[model samples]
Target chain A: MIDWLISGDRPRSVALGAVLLGILFSLAFAPFLFPGVRALDTAATILIFIVLVASYDLLLGYSGIVSFAHTMFFGLGAYGVALASIHMGPGWDALIVGALAGALSATVLAYAIGLFSLRVRAIFFAMITLAVASAVAVLVSQLFQLTGGEDGLTYRIPRALTPANRVGELFGVRINGRILAYYLLFFSCTALFLLLLRIVNSPFGRVLQSIRENDFRSEAIGYRVVAYRTAATCLSAAMAALAGSLYAIWLRYVGPDTTLSFEIMIDVLLMVVIGGMGTMYGAVIGATIFVLAQNYLQNLMGAASDATSALPLIPDLINPDRWLLWLGVLFVLSVYFFPTGIVGRLRAGR
Target chain B: MTQTLLETTDLTVRFGGHVAVDHVTCAFRAGELTAIVGPNGAGKTTYFNLISGQIGASAGSVRLLGQDITRMGVARRCAMGLGRAFQLTNLFPALSVLENVRLVIQARRGKGFNLFSIAASHVEMTTAALAVLERVKLGALRDQKVSELSHGNQRKLEVAMLIALDPQVYMFDEPTAGMSVDEAPVVLDLIAELKHDSDRTILLVEHKMDVIAKLADRIIVLHNGALVADGPPAEVIASDVVQKVYMGREIADV
Candidate 1:
């Protein structure tokens, strides 16, 4: 059914095909592509990062709000979900509740900032968000009792949201493992992606683009300029929270590092900008690139370790802690050659 | 004889000690077509801005239908039965011509927050928008994207958008500035029709003497941010000050 829907090239068919393909591809490849804690951890990092970037792009790319505090919303989601889960214990319902909590908390925070700063466009809005994120990070770190401080919190969870009672029985076949978890996350990501796609194509989406093109004209037409900005801000934040909540659930752990880390924020930004800021599929492309690059690059370094330890080119010369430096260089290069990112370049070609 | 629908009192706008608009006072009455004529830098556009609330009045007040609206924002002022067609074409270019007009109708109805519904599917709004487009003879171009429309059509679209809101008072700043000779009469016809509507008031800033002489029932002449003459167009245009303002100090030689 999904394949038939995807194979058709009409507008509706194209949309459905893209969505089904996304879901199928993610579910089919997640296990083999990302195995064990190390691989799963890296893949998870890329997934959450992509979600964050997509959330940012929804506002910055479409609505023209350059927000730097996107990580703050991600943190809010992570912290909100983790805290909610800690008090309630892990369950299918608990995960849903946690996601909702994360979204609500991020929305509230975004609302406060948006109410005051939506009037300030471009660099000013970006600065305000950065300040807010830094402040939240500081507050989280100082509150060791509730947050478990820098070390973070750990949890044990049932194998599944419903806790598969018959571990190896799914359609009379085996379906018990981390593969199930991967498929669960893959579905979640795809659902959010489709919802975003619907929003950007709608009338409301056109208005947002109009706002981006020229705000004064939008106001002249009686659209409340600030109101649109606020709504977009909250919606973007909520999407980031959804991603964060998934991360907490998948890992069964949450902490300040997950929420407040500068590294996490940059990673998300990289995915969106490198993949294509405004294009809907840019986040997925970005995540795939980021994950593949990190995996292969690390493996290449490991392979060369025996031969190059005496005259190490990267790890010895530059602190491994600064692996982000290389990512920064890549970002700069992408900005120079493909300012619109991959999706943007493809759009320009078309 | 018609009641004043919009008025500005001693409207002074200053930019860093230089007065852009200096103590200009005017009133626009329902059923009246008024032309404000001045050469470039005569504060005509500044006065329009002050009335439209695009920029805050440095020291003055604006009254709309006898209510003080000095502090109101542009959107609120628009919602309060005031509409403006800009000197420059200000429009949503990516939207279809019909959608552009529908925006103003939607604004007047104040249903902008129906997030779940498709905007293009709003039947009543689309009908109203198309009606205005038809009035401007832009109905044929309704489905075309605004960016695809020609400059004159875009200007007509701007006017149609303003008309769709059904404002009690319409402010048009140089409405025919970029129009061809053929296009100018269509705008003149629309303005004349608007003036004849009995309940509609029109205020315009124009340099075109032909339009001013043809359409203006009352003409207010300004020179260097001050009123030089205010009366019927024949009387005001006949004034030596008005003749000199138009002829640039060489009317006697001409």
Candidate 2:
């Protein structure tokens, strides 16, 4: 089964694995197998990031175009739903409309960016996107009325998704709105992940890979390089917007820091790089590992620091509040040991 | 009776006071294999680049089948049947040998925009790719990564990709550049075969005199970014100016 899953040129096995992983993650939130609210929440966050980073990989890994504007699209999606819910009143219908609105806006934004900046050199394109994204981040933070300013926006989700609605018991666990919300996230993320997998394995994807390898050759072979890159940017941004919408729904809040911040963009970059740049499976694995480590590793370090406080030198290095220092060490070690990222190493092992 | 397939009228490219391809006006006639020969920095490659639309001309126009394509982008020019092979062996290095050919085939077939269909499962593309690979005699190495192939085989693969494109005009820039003497003939033979199709046109830049003598019906020699020699191969070889600027005393002695 492992061979069947990992040994193919096509992405079907990887797509299947992603779907299965999504289902398992959703199941972890169930009461009987419950790992607690914090763990379940972390798992849900990981699933959402899987979608973000995988969509990101479509550009970074598949097309070899790096832009810092992904979180802008993501934030657009979150804000789309948040604003819609506040104005139109919270319900499933409004949420869907908001998600669609976000996706459309992101697609349009990406198309415009692609038109203006894609013709420049890659490094220049990156800088252009960075400048544009920073401006948008500042705009979102300063829009006191519409965006709720620096404090961010809080709005209602669908009644069915809120904790007040109990959907009945399942497997000795009382299934409620929160569980429904988890499953909702699971199914949507899985579907989006699968769709992206199919796209990257398609003829279009082949051309994107060709462009990445040799843009001049791809152009010489009759591929409109700029057009294809634009299409990829739009597709990646739209998917990211969808992930962002899900994030807004799950949290019942949309804040600049949580959605459009540069830190989130950096996190996605880290996920793709540590996961493996070119492999889609790398995104899934990378997000899971990174999110889990971010959530649990700090607490684990805190406990260790307390335990080792009497040990003098060890206490300083294992500082509880500075747990990210250890994670930084782990990240450096992983990059050194598995230079190609985890999925890259796994694929190489195969 | 052969018609002009491509013509560049006073095509000029200048880089900050340095003339790379200086006002080269040449025509590639259908059903002929024309060789552009010169010493290093003779602007043969730059001339090819100007015609292939890889770079814009500072001044001049390229007429392809009577259409002005000077300002056209590389992909559009290629779609209009202008194919090129790079001197540096540009290829999808990580892709399989088959995939490199298949992408060209796919591009020509107009399936490059198809996002929903699986590339590997496209039987038509695979069949076309395989046929081109077989023609180039690299069919046995189809599944191998291009990086794993020998430099000679990679050069052949580049030709195969162009063949799959089925361009009306082919621009070859040192297709045999890095090949051994023994391996050079294999590519020369493949290029020779293209001349049998009377409607196809070939523009080649080569340094090896033997290969030029064997294949090029006509030779256009460039010296300091200017065309100094243009005629049949034997006449061009015997031209005093060609010997002075490009051929040098060595080929004259021979």
Candidate 3:
């Protein structure tokens, strides 16, 4: 059965199987999962993280380019949706408009930065993106009146998914609660993931790989290196924006703290690196680890704090404040033990 | 009459104050084997770089089949029918030999944007790419990863890539630079076959005297970034300037 699942030539089949499994698992344990929040919230976090990480991998692992500003696109998408909800009606229009605005803004930034930085390779290109992101972060923080500065903004949204919806009925399930949101998020990820599979296997994707391997030889073959890289960057940004928009709707809030945080960047980086750079499913693995670990650590810490004087051992065992420190150690260990990342090591063994 | 495929008139490539390739004019005509010979610092490789559009020419113009291509990019020039094999082996090390050839095949087919089509779906291009590999006797190694191949095999793969493009003009920089005595003839034979049988317009920069003597229909000698001699092998090799350039002294015995 395991072999049957991964045996297909089409990457879509694998993605389909993975999505179906995730949906099934969530539905089976829906009652026990996040009682106050819907199953959809869980799905949303996974979907958003997966999309962000995969997009980051496409650029970093496949194209050999890094952008610190990638999270800026995610932030913009969330902000756009929040601002739209505050000003426009909730339904689907605000979501669409917000995503478009984020995409357009990211594409514009990608084109301008791509024009200059694409000529240089490796560290220089990485630094250029870091510089751009830092500058943008400063700019966002300075827009105090419009952006609500450090405090961030919150926007109201109508419920779009519940366990009793029509989508849930297809699976003999009800989406009247959070379970419906999980289905929506799962379906979106599956669809976008299928599209991503197509894009990665395409001729354009080969050119991107060729650029990664040898830019001069690819140029010799008549490919405009900059044009293609910029296209990938824009596509990656746009997909990330979609994910971000969904995130905003799921949380019903938006803030510069979410958009401009280095934590988001670290998560995306970790997803691509530890999960296995260049592989599409790396994002999913990375996101699962991150979200699950955060939830577990926070619960452990909360339990310890509640116990106060008696639970010194438990506090020491699950320190929430030291998560980043642990994460850094994990990254170093991953690099040392599996230099090619997880998937790369598996492929090499084969 | 056959046409000229590549013509460089007074081409000079200057880096700062130094002339790497100075005022070199040469025409590479179809069905002719042209050899460029020079010492280590003689700028022969630089001349190839200028013609291949790898570097900008500070003076003069390069024409491809009568179209002025002085400002054309390397990839554009390649599409216009210029193929170049580098002095160093530059095959895609991570890919299989066949995959590397398939990449060029896809480029030639201009199907670089087709996402839905599987790689195996490119039957005709794959067949042609395979045929080119077969021609270079690299067909047996097609399934092997390029990095796994020996240095000589890698060079053969590079030549195979050049051939797979079916370019109008083939530029080889030191085709046998790292080849052993036994491996040198394979390259010489390929060059001879390209000239005598396939009628390819060939421009090569080689240090191997025996290979040059065997294959060069016409030889042009370079010294200090300038062309010193251009003629048939015997006349160019016997010239006072050529002899002095190669031996660092006049040929007193001759």
Candidate 4:
């Protein structure tokens, strides 16, 4: 059963397996365990980032194709949800339609971009995606009425998905639309993660990995390197779009800053690298570590500053505002210590 | 001629006015092992590249079983039964030796695009891949990653992949280029076994005169991107022009 669940691709390390289970159980019962609004949001955000980063890994890790337009697909999904809510009214039907629309656009755009650039080479794919993503970001911010401009859009979903609509009281926690929404994200993300796991273990996934190892060899062996790379790009883009849809649905808001930011792309890259680039479980671990750090690192710094008030220059150096600097330090330390990322480190039994 | 399996017409390629391969035409046939021999800069490898679709021709066409395939890319040509093994041992280095061969079989079976098929559950495919691995005596190292394998082992894995491909035309660019003195015979024996099939067309590029004399039935010598000699191995080796251009001047230059 475990083999079927993970598609026979074990974590290959007892510690990694235990940590993954810890994460899974924690995420599965997040509301009951955490029971706070901010914590719930952070957990959901982590789940969303897991899907996004794993999708990107399909292109970069599996196929050796580096694309920078991941957020563009993510944004399209968000906007699809936003536009559907605003135009077609707040219904589950609208959500489905919006998600389908978003995924379709992302897939088509990815196919177009991949066909144009992937056939040429890797660097060209990266450059073209960066340019296209930037262009899309500018277009989203410029088209005020259509995409809500720079201010973004705020819309509503069904009452069962909001904070106030309490279904009942279970234990100390409120049984409300918010918890339902969280569960929705949880199940979807888990299914998506497992699906990705299955894909990487499939024959198609082998081809992609082979391409990463040696494209000329793959071609000589009868696999079309460009076609496989392009297919990977399209699939990754669509998955990112689905993730964006869930993100919009969770927040009930969509905007360039939230979904289309290039920073998010960089974060995804960092997460993929930090967790382990070539595995789906890497996304799970990397996104959890990163999202947790992003949220509570500031609090840790503020508390450190308070405790170190008597120290000279130390408090200022470790100030809450220097979280980004500390994050950089953390990234460097990880790359130094793990080299292949934490998952890789654990898998190697080191 | 047994059966013309592959033909090239005026096949040529230029690297910026430097004609790496001049207008050379030849036909490869079933039940024949043709050895392409050359001195340095004779374009033997370039001609292989042209026929295999690794590079576009400046002025030529490649016909496989009477189908024009000059414009087809590497993968397409491979799918059409044009199998090529490189001198450099191009292989998926991070994957297991079993997987490296299994992928070629999957590709030949048109199952490379399958998204949900568990590779291990494909019992027939696994057995077939294992059989191919055993052919090159890599069955024991099936689970070992190609990157970790020795250079000679990787070369053997390359031939395993080629055997799995089961192409009509088998092209080897110095199959024994980097093997040890002992390891060279394994690949040579495999090529000899394939040559016994009688319906398969084999093309080889080799610098080792001993290897050429042993495996190749026909020898085609290229000098400065042009065909200099074509006949039996003994005839070509003893030919006056080949003795002078290939053995004497080129040897002196080296």
Candidate 5:
């Protein structure tokens, strides 16, 4: 059954499988088990990012493409949902239309970028994506009336998805629309992740892997490298846009800072690298750990700093204000120790 | 004329002021094994690159069975039945040996785009890929990564990939350059086997005289970016141009 889900590409490491299962179970029961607002938000965010990070993995890890314009696609999806809700009013149709429009636009933009710049060297493509992403960021900030500008757009979704719509009780936990929204994100992300798994295990995915290994030889072997790259780019962009739509629906808001930020792009890159490049499961582990650490690590640091306030230098060094510093340290240590990312390390150890 | 499999008309490539391949016109007919020989820095590989669409021709054209493919991309040319192996082994080093060959077969068959189909579920394709691997004597190591294979085995794997591609025109650049004597015969034997088909054309670029003498039906010698001699192996080997240039005696033409 597991083989069917992943199309027979095993996780290959017992520890890795356990971690993935743990994440799956926790996500599946987060609303019931965690029973708090912040925890639910974090869980929902992780679910959304699982799709976002995994889609990025398909591009960077599977196809050897380094694209910085991922946030542009994500923002497009958010804005798509935002604009649809504002113009068309709160409903499922608006959400669907907005998501589709965002995905379509993102795919088209990716194809255009891929066709124009993929012919150049990898570094040049990276530069082009960076430039394009920056331009989109600038545009989103300047397009005030249309996009709500820097402040971003906040609007309604279906009433059933909001915290106000109580849907009774389940196992001592009050069931509400927010819980429904969380489950919606959960199931959609799982299905999407499985689809990505199927793709990476398919013949099409192997061609991308081969291209990543040696593109010059892939061309000689009759696989059009650029065409496959463009196709993967388009697919990845659409997936990311879908993830963004989910995020906007959950947050009930879309802003440049929330969706189109460079930090989010960096986070996606970090998650992919920390998870392992080619292994899709790495995305799950990576996003879970990175998001958890980002949210909770500072709290732990703050407590530690308070405890060590009696000591002069220690409190200042490990201060909660420097959570980013600690995060950087963690990233460096992971890269140094794991080298191939956590999943790669575990698989190698196995 | 035995259905010319590939032809080049004044095909040339230049890097700034340097002409890497200069106005090289040639043709390969069916059922013939043609060897391209040259002194160091002669444009033998460059000419192969031009023919295989690795590098575009600065001037002139390349045609496969009378269809002009000069502007075609590498994959397009391969799809149109042009198969080439590199002088240095080029392969998916991180993939298993079987997977490397299977991808070629998948691409050639145009089924590499099946997003939902499990690659292993294609039992017939796997069998076919394994058969090609067996022919190249890599069947035993099918599960091993290409990077783990010895240089000679990688070269054999390169041939296996080409065979799987099933192109009418086969371009091999120094196929046995790094193989041991025992390993060399396997590749030579496979080339000999490929030559058995009357519809196939083989082009080899090598510096070894004995291998050229043994396998090549005809020999073409290049002297510093230009085709200097073309004839049967015995005739070209005995010619003054090959004797002075290829044998490395001082020659002014280069």
Candidate 6:
């Protein structure tokens, strides 16, 4: 099993690298190590985004299908778990059932969307997904009685995952609910990432790449192009939904802004681009870099702003509040110079 | 009499005010190499597209092995043994040459939907794909990316993919469209070798008279979306109608 996990040169290295990164991130989140660092919650958020971005890459990078509706599926998964926990009363079993429900719903919805929209041209298909996703986002926000409107829904996870439940201690660190939740996110994300790696390396994945390169030729060669594409859509959606379920459990809440917002969709797209499209490792690297930047870069910029408050430059330009502006500039520069993403550049070097 | 393998009746396609493939009727007999010769915009490709189900016909019915397949899709036609190579070389550019051919072999072996197994680990598929590469004389370059190959080699790779399909009816639309003078004969010879099989029916669209002369058992001349002449090459070459419409003074002089 270990050998299989790190089989191919590039893929093996990538998988092993992901494992190492996961461990390092987990260690950073541990209470005993880096006690002054208060970024465990942020670290957990980055792990969830790894799963989400990788899932998105499965569609956009591997299959060459540009879908703006990915966040809708992500939102569905989160809401699924949230509603299930609220209705069934919080428990570990309820969380499992909710995750399953979310994944299933996302799969069904993806199938329908893929069937109807995949028949159209690529650009038209993208537009249709965008329109459908926007509509669903509005619908989720307006359903006050069930979805909690704009206020969102809050529910308890299993007691073991709550902050109040302290499991024990390990390596001079207290293993409480927060620590347990971090580890849970770590293992699940790693497993899902490996599964995606397996899928993209499989024969089915090869056909998807062929279709991506030339759909007409793929069809001409006797592959059912639409069916393969639809299958890819469903698989990617289910993975994204699973990530969303885990995300909701981690946050202990689900809301339109946090779950189904267009910003989340853009963030995923940015991650894929910055990490590199078509390389699975891009998702892992992209999410890590983006999340870290989103969390720490703002603080770093704020410190700079405090020291340079008397500068004659435009106040808005140097304002720490405009961290996103600096991030956007970095994103554009990365795309321009490293268009293939960080993984792509690394592969090219070797 | 040779059994009819494919038949097209009153096939027509109109682009609004223009008729691309006018009322045309034709038949491809089993075990014959038939070449469709025409000038640019003569609808040679549009005709291939209509019969191959690449485009919806304005009016016509296509029958393969005596079964009507006019409404069938491009993929269904391919599954039913109608293989087509595009005028422009179409292939998975990023994939290795062997992988490209293996995909076709995998499609034929009915393993396209197998998601669990690694594609390269399929011994049978790999062996068959390698055999095809050797036949096309692309064995040494099998590991090279398709994009790395020259235009002529890419054309051969395209034909190799068609060969992997082992289709009963083969359609080649300008297979040597952009090949160098020396490279054109390589593809022409490949077509001739396939034509040697009495069970295979080959329909090719060619501009080079030398290739058509060497391979065509019969010649069908299309001018402005209509069949103007059809017969043995010698007879068609002698026909004033073909000479006037297509062969012109230069081909006649040759």
TM-score leaderboard ranking: 4, 5, 2, 6, 3, 1
Residue A327 deviation, candidate 1, in Å?
5.6
Q: For model 1 chain A, where is the 10-residue window of minimal lDDT?
A: A3-12
DockQ score of the complex predicted as candidate 1? 0.34
Reference-based TM-score of each model: 0.84, 0.94, 0.88, 0.97, 0.96, 0.93
Clashing residue pairs in candidate 6 (N, C-alpha, C atoms within 3 angstroms): none
Best of the two (2, 5) by TM-score: 5
Give the poorly placed runs of model 2, Cα more than 4 Å off.
Answer: A1-32, A303-316, B247-250
- How accurate locally, in lDDT, is each candidate? 0.76, 0.87, 0.75, 0.91, 0.92, 0.87
- List of clashing residue pairs for candidate 4: none
Please give the lDDT score for candidate 2: 0.87
Interface DockQ per candidate: 0.34, 0.68, 0.53, 0.83, 0.83, 0.65
> What order do you get sorting by lDDT, best first?
5, 4, 2, 6, 1, 3
Candidate 5 - CAPRI tier?
Answer: high
Q: What lDDT score is found at residue B103 in candidate 2?
A: 95
Taking chain A of candidate 6, what TM-score results? Answer: 0.92
**Tens digits of per-residue lDDT for model 2, B126-203:** 998999999888999999999999989998998888888999998888888888778777778889999899888999
Q: Share of real interface contacts recovered by each model?
A: 0.35, 0.86, 0.49, 0.88, 0.90, 0.70
**lDDT of candidate 6 vs native?**
0.87
Worst 10 residues of 5 chain A by lDDT: A1-10
Worst 10 residues of 2 chain B by lDDT: B245-254
Candidate 3 lDDT, A165-210, residue by residue in tens:
3433334444463555555566676666656655665667777778
Q: For candidate 1, what is the TM-score? A: 0.84
lDDT (Cα, tens digit) per residue for candidate 5, span A1-350 = 87898899888999998988899999999988898999999999999999999999999999999999998998888899999999999999999999999999999999999999998899888899899999999998898989988999889999999999999999999999999999999999999999998898899999999989999999888888989999999999999999999999999999999899999999999999999999999899999999999899999999999999999999999999999999999999998898799999999999
What is the lDDT, from 0 to 100, of the residue B36 in candidate 2? Answer: 92
Native-vs-model 5 lDDT? Answer: 0.92
